[model samples]
Target: MSEQAKENPILEVESVHVAYGRVQAVRDVSFSVPEGGLIALVGANGAGKSSVLAAVSGLVRPGSGRIRLEGKDITRWPAHKRVGAGLVLVPEGRQILGTLTVAENLRLGAHRRRRQAAPESEMYELFPVLAERRALPASALSGGEQQMLAIARAMIARPRVVLLDEPSMGLAPKMVDEVFAVIERIRASGVTVVLVEQNARRALRAADTGHVLETGAIAHSGPAAHLLKDPRVVKAYLGVE
Candidate 1:
């Protein structure tokens, strides 16, 4: 990452608030993600992590404040436009089209910019299992494989930043490890990552920074390593598991 981009965050959410009808989902939440760095938003359900991502991804409009990507205001851009501008979100569920062939599903991901997207062969290289089952229906894959497919689909969009919501949510322990390893590879390849995960310890462990949200506000924010050992964080979220 360039020093300038890191100094001035590639993606910035400034005092953003989100509401659904009369109930507020996010309240004056703000954070900046450095280019190519990974940040995790960790909190219990209903704490508003997903709402924050939704606002940024343009799935839902923020009621107030602003969102910027690479220093350009994109608060009102539509979701497809955001995707076209290199902001991609892999939603909570592995939302791959079950009936489509694996290759077909991957092809759909590059709909925005085919030239910039990695070749199908390259995606196959990243997820060998996907290649092995390319001709098969997506439903034929295991949960872990489906999750890999979901990520591969997003990557094919040539994203500059990826917003991951609960990537490890439903998998077995071993599968969860595999998914996180993939996440590491993605960040290593220079894509900024905003991860909202339920597994606080694992998320914090993998992130450059960690934000602990409570009741729609950030209760704690710091370097991931510091958050890992924080007494209050450990007691409230990490637990003794």
Candidate 2:
């Protein structure tokens, strides 16, 4: 939505590296996320897409380089601190509290730290299924329903940017469609999004920009439309004929 000239990035990852003991997971990777834009990191498992997202969310500390939010370095900040600073991560799996009712889980997500969270009424409007089962225990929901609850939980916190890792993992085909629809709505709401998904085609289709990762490094980077149409990308990642 930003007219090219004045577009400024809200988050920047500069030469970031992440390691797990002897294994290097991310190798000097860097990218910028513009405010209200959606970027996707797509690759096979072990390609380090999740690791990069973890580093950004402060769920895992990068071995080196800088992570900035609104141009302020936050590489050393803790996870909760980053959340308080308007960053939230809906991690790899939908991590809803199984015992709590859907409404209770939503209320908990809007902790005192939220600068401005969506009202429960608005969340119900955004996720009608959640509203339909508002009083049901989280465990009663299907995998797709749980994913919706997970996303709603994050959105209720009103983060400036959200990091979503593998949101479509383990979802049914119809559910995957619904999840993507919600993602588009999230982007339209002006919240910057960083998505890591294994379904390359769908992810690229939903993104403003797409980055293909291989062996912990970016193998391709371009506008989403370009990446989707790239012959090599189509053959190697998109799984289309």
Best candidate, TM-score: 1
Q: Which ranges in model 1 have alpha carbons more than 4 Å from their true place?
A: none
How well does each candidate superpose onto the true structure, as a TM-score?
A: 0.98, 0.96
lDDT, candidate 1, at 230: 97
The lDDT of each candidate is: 0.94, 0.92
What is the lDDT, from 0 to 100, of the residue 129 in candidate 1? 88
Candidate 2 lDDT over 79-166, as tens digits, reads: 9999889999999788899999999999988982555877889889999999999999999999999999999999999999999999
- lDDT string, candidate 1, 70-178, tens digits: 9999999999999989999999888999999999999999886676787889899989989999999999999899999999999998799999999999899999999
Scanning candidate 2 in windows of ten residues, the lowest lDDT window is 1-10
Q: Model 2: which residue pairs collide?
A: none
Q: How much is 155 displaced in model 1, in angstroms?
A: 0.3
The global Cα lDDT (0 to 1) of model 1 is 0.94
Task: Name the weakest run of 10 consecutive residues (lDDT summed) in model 1.
Answer: 110-119
